[model samples]
Target: MQDKPENLSREYILPDGRSVTVGDQLFRAPEALFAPREVEAQGPGVVGMVLRSLARCSSRIQLDILRNVVLSGGSTLFQGFKERLLKDLQAAIPSIAPVKIFSPENRILTAFRNMWITREDYYEVGEHKVKDI
Candidate 1:
């Protein structure tokens, strides 16, 4: 993995004239997405969720699924997020599966254009139905 210079600590002054220093927390905060326990959350992280979802599908389609993974949304815009996910998935799954992640340059916009869901629709159908989209 390439080291990120942006991870360096920097000081910022708030509108009220108070100074605050930010450091590795920016990077560490995102780690919770991969290891939820670090933030005292229950259940598996994103990769585990993907694996569990795959397990529910028929074995014949597992390979197809792994080869066409698409990542969308603002959270996925974090630096190195896609590469890290691909690496983790490759490590967790069988070698022959050949994990691939497709992250468009404008993922959020792409999602909005192709997969936008209304608040009412989401509430009506719930998470399980939304996942199938």
Candidate 2:
């Protein structure tokens, strides 16, 4: 996060010809994912969410899921977000399973396509096809 370029700053101008320089604003939103307490709000952070999800899955698949974690959404694009998430998850998850986090080249598009899959892309059930559902 500290490696951000110097010129990467957000600025606001006041009515009296004064300017307000905003630094690190880009890093703030994603910070909530890791340190929700610092942001001061309800609910668990991203690591907590992942742990909760892992807890619900079968023990056999838990390690596999951790090893192949895929993060979706625009917030995942933040610098070092994936690495930080992996580090936190690794520390929190029990066992010595390796943790890997992957963000798709275009996560939003991938999510949209997954939600809107074509009929031919899905398998058929006992008496009905995917399109029938």
Candidate 3:
């Protein structure tokens, strides 16, 4: 069987034999992450969030932070997500700042292993203080 072109709409028959059409939503849904305003969201998208977060950090560490960017979780699993993010960051960031994004094969698992706040520590420090951890 030949693969259907992504730009074209396709129909899938349900197990109960009803047919439903799938269209640009498949492409647009993922794209919303990069361009939230396209979907009527008020704030910046993923790339903007990354840039804003980096801006909030000390400038002395911004280069180090860019070098060690690691993308995890289900959203990062999308094909070309890392490349797209890197491309967008490079375009937005100064030429002197290098951009690197890593997507490990077991990203979700790796993220869980590396990032955590103990319940006891959170309770002791309170929510606001724990956020900096």
Measured by TM-score, the strongest candidate is: 1
- Residue-level lDDT tens digits of model 3 in 1-133: 7545475786899999999998876667778899998899877998999999999999899999999999878888866788889999999999999988878888867657745778887788888765575
Residue lDDT tens for model 1, 1-133 = 8668575887999999999998887777778899989989898998999999999999999999999999988889888899989999999998978998999888878656846678898899889667877
Candidates in order: C-alpha RMSD to true structure: 7.5, 7.4, 7.1
* Root-mean-square deviation of candidate 1: 7.5
Q: TM-score-based ranking, best first?
A: 1, 2, 3
- What lDDT score is found at residue 74 in candidate 2? 77
TM-score of 2: 0.69
What are the Cα lDDT values of the candidates?
Answer: 0.87, 0.79, 0.84
Worst 10 residues of 1 by lDDT: 108-117
Pairwise TM-score winner, candidates 1 and 3 = 1
Decreasing lDDT order of the candidates: 1, 3, 2
Which candidate wins on lDDT? 1
For 1-133, candidate 2 gives per-residue lDDT tens digits of 4556445787899999999987777677778888888789777899999999999999999888988999888778888988899888878866578888888888756556645545465543433443454
